[model samples]
Target: MSAFPAQPLYLVANGPLAGRVSVPGDKSISHRAIMFASLAVGESRIEGLLEGEDVLATVAAMRAMGADVARGGDGVWRVHGVGVGGLLQPQTALDMGNSGTSTRLLMGLVASHAITATFVGDASLSKRPMARVTDPLARVGASFTTAPGGRLPLTMHGACPAIPLEYVLPVASAQVKSAVLLAGLNTPGITRVIEPIPTRDHSERMLRGFGADLTVEESARGRVISIRGEAELKPQHIIVPGDPSSAAFWMVAASIVPGSDIVIANVLMNPTRTGLLTALRMMGASIDEIDRRDVGGEDVADLHVRHASLSGIEIPADLAPSMIDEYPVLFVAAAFASGRTVARGAHELRVKESDRIAAMAAALGACGVACTEHEDGLAIEGTDGDPIPGGATIATHLDHRIAMSMAVVGLHARAPVVIDDAAPIATSYPGFVAQAVLLGAEAR
Candidate 1:
């Protein structure tokens, strides 16, 4: 395991956080924008793209694979695609760092092309499961020589004449769905994915916008997404909206902290990814949507959040796919609420960069919060108005979400909450500490 500073920062409960904050661009959309732009026929300009390490890794990989990609002024990135089936083999191993999304999706993109590539990553990413993408891609004639148990540090040999197959997602994962669709880009005929539970639809929406022949049909089982293979994708300008996941941290912090009211601007309110907003509303958060509009095919709105008395409610299992990444922060909200909050149908949490369910439970327990962790989910019991005793040091395990979640917990704790390592926060949210400080969160 990589070791960093375990020295903890103390957070004294402060007055209401009053400010307007704009989070960075969506990480998922940023990754796909780079990937799709590199595969399109012309130059694709992207504004408001996330420049985090994870997305930067995608940029480096694209450039290594012979795509012209560079950053211009003010979060603007330009990528010139070689064509649909025109990717060159990389000279070195593609390092995906801590991004599971990048690793899985890139595996799919390289799987159907006529090149061979190797993928490596940091310790946290090396442990993440790759079987989710590899198994499905294998069904469509992509071959992999992976590390034991389908971990990273593996080589993938793309099928020259790729096979097209129908895939039914075993879980509600946008990564899995995107992987199959990307691999199908170089194959012949229609490549279809059946998602019983819809995850984030950025890949589908963005793909359709890029001039791909993509179709979606709703059935009793779930949503069926079909993409025609071997079509030339026309590059276009893309404007990424602020990540709702990143915005969620500030929303939770502002809501539970007394006298706090904050507005997050230009947040993507895609229904497929708005379960946290809905859950917060159910728990008595005074949040309002204002100036709703569409930007680049995503629903954009300003969220007005104010402090209110919150009571916990059972989170529906069906909503897991929508806000999977927000659960750790949601657990923070649960700790400060009244009554019990139970989260189910989150077995996928175990396969993330870390076992997030177990990590959150352990960290919360360390901070004097009562929590019960299951194989898939957790149950958190709130102390009503009692301050959470937070004089504990929790191990972050090099997971960015874990670190950020623990920091959120510190906002309302009687004492300061300290995380063992804050280093991993750079993977997705590079300016997390600065942004949190601006929002009146104390982080050292």
Candidate 2:
């Protein structure tokens, strides 16, 4: 979380984990906070913002586009926007680092303004599917010159007074949904998105909170979201909760490792992001929610989890969108369950920072766990609460989730699991190793 991480992390086989830990602010919400606040009319103050590299990329991009973004000594971020449709063309290319959320979301913001900007990213991000957003934005009059395969290192020419169109999401992706909606912030009239599957609703909620005219109507087809543009965005004070996605690693590690009990504090309990919790509960993990409250209009809770025997079952595909980012850790949990765990309807995993299914599958198999990878998901044969025979070095491919998930595997492995290039963990969970060590795990 400090700067670029150069040292590779080493997480060894450790004793039982106990006590409490709190992760950083929600990555998704942190990106949105800096973005939404930058687009509002007045100075917006955000508390508990995530300092991870991914979200920080959003902060830098917003600042590059002529927004005054600054962090105080007290750790709150303040942003003064040029209002909707007032963003200036950047003088240089926006370096998105390794964040898909920052790239896709900022692409939407730039698409509706009368500006020209270029987006570039790290190697992993350059291979991601940007067409999901670019394709929809093209219909709204934005023009793009992308790298081969519709990848990054692309330039975009924004369309002033862009045409409003109704878009239907072909996939369950929050980034795509948010990109379209963020573009609608400037275009005149109502822009609608018809989602066949519900993704996260953070953008819609924050848009409305910032005083944008956005409405949602649910029908059999899916959720119908309409946004009216050429509107003023009012600044707000936002208190972001802990990222549920980040909390997922500990949730799985505690539940699967023997004699482990831990409490994670101030976690975002939004229904959409709690899919991992629900799925774990269905798998028979002993997780309890306490200190329930509301923070910044989103549900917040403290999770107290104790180790329990888990039985694998068919993971409901509908929960995929909610727990998309948590799948790698969940797959680790599945590796130690009672029976075969089937995770289908998650083809999206193939396109993340790395092919998550393949990454986890290979890592689990390396650790002596039997896992079969499907095109869409994976089927893992659990050891049924047994320690895995580790002593394998996993290739993390510069992916934070892949590195952390395998680190969890190391906790209960008979031998130490050495992660290749654990530097990627700084992308999201910056202090992951320190926290793991604090929880009585041998992580470096």
Candidate 3:
């Protein structure tokens, strides 16, 4: 657990939410930008990076490994990279905070370099399994000593001239795939990954943007991605768009709260991250795309969402990978819909910051919403637009999405809902409550 004290937030039903708002930059892109820039041969400039604690952990880790990283008064971040295979051994352990993305991805980067580093994190992060990453890296000649259950507070000894090999993903995890790809950056020869199920392609896109010799080919087995190791990477300017995950809360909130009409600007519309938008649309949400365009090699658009009568529908299993992070809030939307919402094929949710399936089940039950938890997903019987009983203090379990999702539930509930600790929300959306209040929410 963090040393910080728990900060509770009370939220009650409010009037219509209105106005155009912008969320922070994409966390995934922000982390990648910092990482790729730190591996480039020259200075790289980044615009609109998310300053959240999670992304900052990546910044601090890169700096500790000899990258010159700083944010100027103009709010632009500049990084002077040490080049591929040039990372210096850190003087101390890398504290990853609550970012699993940072810990896993960085483990891959350090695997093929000639350095040894220790990684530590907060209690929540410490419990997450790192073996998925460490296992593949071990095959690449890197060695690790981890806590029991392959958890955090671990040491990794990077391999010099690491061996490159082809590996297949047993699960559909972008993090694991990205880890292997990143480790390939400093290895000799070519590293290949056979992905049976497609996940986010940010690493592939950003890697190419930084001039890494990476290629993707479709086949009967799935997508075969190959990256030539020990290649020179050139620095470039990067602009991060608004995170769709952050925008998801507003999308669902506006859908459930009567009379809500809000404009969310600069949200990334990458197909891999738009499953929530697609899912909500299937549930009869009134969301319109405004000025869809490309920004920084990715699709982005402003969303104009209005309150509509939502109907529960079976969530497609294939859509899980695209909107996994948004499930908590999606459940909130389901709670107010007409009919039943059944979600399956998302067993991956069990190992997140918390068991999201179980967390949402207990939270909704506390608010008098009926839900059945499954090993893979949940089945929720909606109130069909009626406000369910609230007046409950929800345990956030140090999970940001749980806190924010409950806050949304409070907006349409019969009574106020108290979040046990809103502090975790800062790890991703620091201004969530302030923005909620700005949109006419009765939160304090």
Using TM-score as the measure, the top candidate is 3
Candidate 2 lDDT over 85-184, as tens digits, reads: 8899899999998999999999999999999999999989998978999999999999999999999899999999999979989999899999999899
Q: Which ten residues in a row have the lowest lDDT in candidate 3?
A: 10-19
RMSD of every candidate to native, in Å, equals 1.3, 1.6, 0.8
Q: Write the candidate numbers in order of decreasing TM-score.
A: 3, 2, 1
> What pairs collide in candidate 2?
none
Q: Which residues of candidate 1, in runs, are more than 4 Å off? A: 1-10
Question: How far in Å is the alpha carbon of 427 misplaced in model 3?
Answer: 0.5
Question: 170, model 2: CA deviation in Å?
Answer: 0.7
* Model 2 stretches astray by more than 4 angstroms: 1-6
**Roughly what TM-score does model 1 have, to 2 decimal places?**
0.98
Q: For residues 1-444, what per-residue lDDT tens digits would candidate 3 score against the true structure?
A: 468788999776458899888999999999999999999989999999999999999999999999999999999999999999999999999999889999999999999999999999999999899988998999999999999999989999999899997989998899999999999999999999999989999999999999999999998999999999997999999999999999999998889888999999999999989989999999999999999999989999999999999998999999998998988888898999999999778888888888889998999999999999999888999999888899899988899889999999998888788899999999899999888888888777
> Quick one: ranking by lDDT, best first?
3, 2, 1
**lDDT, candidate 1, residue 48?**
92
RMSD of 2: 1.6
